[model samples]
Target: MSTTKIGWIGLGTMGIPMSQQLISAGYPVTVYNRSKDKEATLKKQGADTAATPAALFQQTDVMIIMVTDDNAINEIFTGKEGLLSAGVNGKIIINMSTVSPSISKEMAALCKEQGNRYLDAPVSGSVKQAETAQLVIMAGGDAAIFEQVKPVLDKMSKMATHVGDVGAGNVAKLAINTLLSIHTQGLAEAVLLAKQNGIEAATLMELLNNGALASPYMKIKGDAILADNYKAAFSLKNIAKDLRLSKDIGLSTPIGEAALKTFGAAEHEFGNDDLIAVKKYLDK
Candidate 1:
């Protein structure tokens, strides 16, 4: 069993399984979520629960955050009864949320002011990867602090890479998500074109899966399209948000612009569905 005490914030789709990985690895874990009901699963797995973010900080040495959007990140850190409210020192805070680099830098400054350490460590896999402990973690922060938390991070990921100083992880996450949007949109377009010309969806998926263009993403999402399963593993709305964040960070190429427009249009009806649901939108 590892000796580092971990405090986890946010218990959404990805957070619950990721924290469970640490617990399975035998590190003591304490979790906090705005919705108290979400804490039950981890608590059942021998993990402790905290009433608030500040209270969690007091109980743990390393704090891991995985929430939705920039506003939620801010609320968890600086809102009433937040981590800084605990006035703790030397606590390492790793934010695994997909938020903007600017907000990460701002939070890092605040953490530094309060004599705490901060790392922006956003991940590259969906809920499946998180559940299986196969996530790819791109982290940004002090190199030494990263090494200090590497063992703890290892329990939740296949690899944890320190990309650069604060906010680089957010930049890396946005870049990869941009490509994910383009790739998924392209796959949807290709399938639609083939189906319109009288080719079967299954036939095209088989060809794509066996050809040089194959990938785990293509396989899984293609199967989802075949089964007509539009459940949200990674939602269309979140990708739209990532594209908007990429635009703010100066992603203005022709392909990027088109992808942004395509996803923006799809956000209304299919936003809550899987990103592969772009096929349904385009087929409409």
Candidate 2:
């Protein structure tokens, strides 16, 4: 294997495709996932599998984590003979999970103390973007460290920008996701309004798609709403989680608080389904 071989832990919807890109790029990628069935495709695509995260880490110079949330990141880092056991000296851990800033700071401090470098790079793109390596990457960490890992990150993202210190990436991601909450929730509400007034949801969405109000994301969300297919492009459960986390930033901001409640209502109405169903709550 090349010394530049990459180790990837996590092979879900986005992670699988993203890792495939690296493997096809000639970076020997060793993947570790709790469920082995999902990775059959990756194996066929010229990737190897490790029995454990530590074993995977042992094979690569850089480790990329693309889990669901902070808890998962923690479990992976602190898993039996995990990242810490691998001893990250001369290695960099690029955390691509969308997690809380406090958690990022904690991870950063831990990595620094152990002579490992950490980068908080929360991505802003869906599965499609991950497959195409067209993701917009917002990264925060040391400039020197970023440059060291730039080539690898470049393989996964179309545009990678360093935001600030280690935890700042999450801060920027939080702000961006905040606007997304507003747009997603607001679009849901508008669709609900049309439905309640006896307008065809599909027809209205078609008009919106061709009108000035259309956004690509909105069209996606609208189609899901029309089909009642909330299959987790982004989970509503996570939307509620993000709003709940954002609420802690500033409760006095009534707008954000309203959004928090709005998404909360969506969670209640949709039963922790696909997040795009936030529109159904508005309809109810």
Candidate 3:
């Protein structure tokens, strides 16, 4: 059995719950969140909290990063007194945050120079999935190191795919989210149009459920739209962030540029509410 302890950084909305799944599985986990109050739940689940990212660096065999964006990810691995300072020899760093693929490669290079390993294992699911270990994980890294982390990953995901090397996982995540954004936005739009065109939304939803358009995601979220409930299963702000990252990836392609403009408008219109509220923007 691998006796490696885990060091987790950025225990925010998604991180806290995911770290708990590890602790609940009886793994020795040390966590650091810039904010201390967020550590409460992880602590209850048997995680030892560190006040600063640097303070927790040398404590584990694998360090998992789950912060918000690329900048935060870079700072943790290369910042003043960051992981590089603590030394990463024989250790692995698994980044589960949604970051730009280019940044993932940069970190991979840095880790190689220092004899550490890097895995970009971004997830697709919300806070609720993190709590239940039902998230889908897309990973990119050396296959050997991925095998090493697979045991722990099982505690966090219902499905974990090792996509390829270095930045492939990030690319896969972006693709998945892009398709999800396109589909969800379409579903939300169709529901709105159906209702406004003198159609009973629930009946339309039932037909959708029984017909070629049926998907549990469509049915459930579509119902939320009809009921006008925009609860934040995944916040609009975060999805906007992903869409923005996707836009950055697609910058050289004209079609992608247009899609970026469209999603950006939705983000601007929806602001910080639930992602399902994207329907509001598609409405007009």
Provide the TM-score for each candidate, comma-separated. Answer: 0.99, 0.92, 0.91
Q: For each candidate in the order shown, give its overall lDDT on alpha carbons.
A: 0.95, 0.81, 0.82
> What tens-digit string does per-residue lDDT give for candidate 3 at 63-82?
99998888898888888868
In the range 106-130, model 2's lDDT, one tens digit per residue, is 8888878888889998889888888
On the 0 to 100 scale, the lDDT of residue 139 in model 2 is 88
Considering only N, C-alpha and C atoms within 3 Å, which residue pairs clash in candidate 3?
none
Q: What is the descending lDDT order? A: 1, 3, 2
Which has the greatest TM-score? 1
Q: For candidate 1, write residues 19-106 as lDDT tens digits.
A: 9999999999999998888899899999999999999999899999999899998888888999989988889999999999999999
Error of model 3, residue 260, in angstroms: 2.7
The prediction achieving the highest lDDT against the true structure is 1
- State, as a TM-score between 0 and 1, how close model 1 is to the true structure: 0.99
Candidate 3: misplaced stretches above 4 Å? 251-259
- Between prediction 1 and prediction 3, the one with superior TM-score is 1
Q: What local lDDT does model 3 show for residue 37?
A: 80
Candidate 2: list runs displaced more than 4 Å: 1-3, 268-272
